[model samples]
Target: MDMRNEATHIARQDGARAASAQQGSAEFLTFRLGAEEYGIDILRVQEIRSYEEPTRIANAPSFIKGVVNLRGVIVPVVDLRVKLGCEKVEYNGFTVVIVLNVRGRVVGAVVDSVSDVLELSGEHIKPAPEMNTSVDTSFITGIGSVGERMLILMDIEALMSSADMGLMDSAQVLQ
Candidate 1:
């Protein structure tokens, strides 16, 4: 190849590497579920609020805690602990509702507590391994390593769609 062509090719490769590095270093909004801390893409988070008693709807799924009136619009809330099959815990002080925008849908996810956002580099993230009958690992996007801790990156869209968590067909539809 000509020297000019070679130089151009090398420059393109360097640019590609820089872009990949930027994409890999993603900022995640962290939250806790039991003792384990989970992370989700920061861009997708809409808002966070302290847990409050929602207007209960009859025939709703067990995981769903019913709808909450946010300003004027009613939004369904899902208890993460019950959704993840974790043992029931008292929602006294640390409980929070993380409103997430996933695939053009807005839903509030109930979590134990909200943690500070953290940036995880590509080298720090590892593919989720097959845990095999312990936990449903399908909802996990990947396992992110932050120092000595591992944050389970949740697939928000998948979690919302699967199991029809009240947002799909709740009896009480807001007019």
Candidate 2:
């Protein structure tokens, strides 16, 4: 029957599409900072949890929002909005902590809210724009776009492990 033949053709087409998507695209977990959106590699994400007040540590950095005990493991929470220099930072019902594993250390990143996971092909991503010497843009891998939405693709591992971040002493300075 012609109808049966058409259904088989449709199934083949769908299978091909799924195969190409798997080979050519990477998945990013999207989240909000202030007004802008950001994307991080989904592999780095451990879990998303409701925001909670963390124990304040003495003499820690301003952006470091203290630490929270996650199943007996203390995770240092960082307000990404503050670290990224957002104009305003507010915590409400929608706020969440994105627990991430960075260089074998588990840390929590506070964000406004999570959007969804996106599979973006290479063509959908653009290289990060160049900035002046004073600004630090090294952790920005690229910019990703889907329809009208634009996402700042971040290399979270690099940002969290860098010496300046002070979250983890990953790169040792031979001084």
Candidate 3:
């Protein structure tokens, strides 16, 4: 190859390497629920708003906190702590609602507090272990470790799309 063509080819190769490095890592929005830490894909998050008392729906499940009006959009909110069977559910000043867009549907998840965005490389994430048969680990995608902190990476879309949530039926999700 000519000298000029060789230099251009080398630069393109470097650019490709940089892009691949970025693609190898994923960003997660970490949050607290009781004493445990959990994370969801940052791309799925729409916004984070302070905890607000939503208008309760009659006869709805306890975990379904209620619905909130977000700029005229009615968004159903779910308490992650309650759904995950946390020992204690408390709403304090630090509590916040994480708005998410799952499969074109808008939903809100209530968490203890909003932590920082964590960038975890593929190597840092480990597969979740198999526990008791009664426990459902389908929603748990993996466990990420960064220094002393460990984050339970959740497949929020799968959890929200489940039959129990009643937000959207599985058939509808497929469509």
Which candidate comes out best when scored by TM-score?
Answer: 3
Candidate 3 residue 47 C-alpha distance from true site, Å = 0.1
Clashing pairs in 2: none
lDDT score, candidate 3: 0.85
Summarize candidate 1's per-residue lDDT along 1-175 as a digit string, tens digits. 4554444445444534553466668889999988898998898899999999888889887888898988777888889899888888889798999998756667889999998899887777665554435344556767788779889887676677664554544323321
Residue pairs in clash, model 3: none
Residue 112 lDDT in candidate 1? 92
Estimate every model's Cα lDDT from 0 to 1. 0.76, 0.83, 0.85
- For residues 1-175, could you state the per-residue lDDT of candidate 3 as single tens digits? 5554444445444434553556588899999998999999999999999999999999999999999999999999999999999977678899999999998999999999999999988767775654545555567777889999999988899889888899996777787
Candidate 3 ranges beyond 4 A from true positions: 1-23
**Clashing pairs in model 1?**
none
Off by over 4 Å in 2: 1-23, 171-175
Q: Ten-residue segment with the worst summed lDDT in candidate 1?
A: 166-175
Best by lDDT: 3
Q: Residue 20 of model 2: what lDDT?
A: 50
Residues 68-131 of candidate 2 have per-residue lDDT tens digits of: 9999999999989888889776799999999999877899999999999999887787656554
Query: Over all chains combined, what TM-score does candidate 3 have?
Result: 0.85
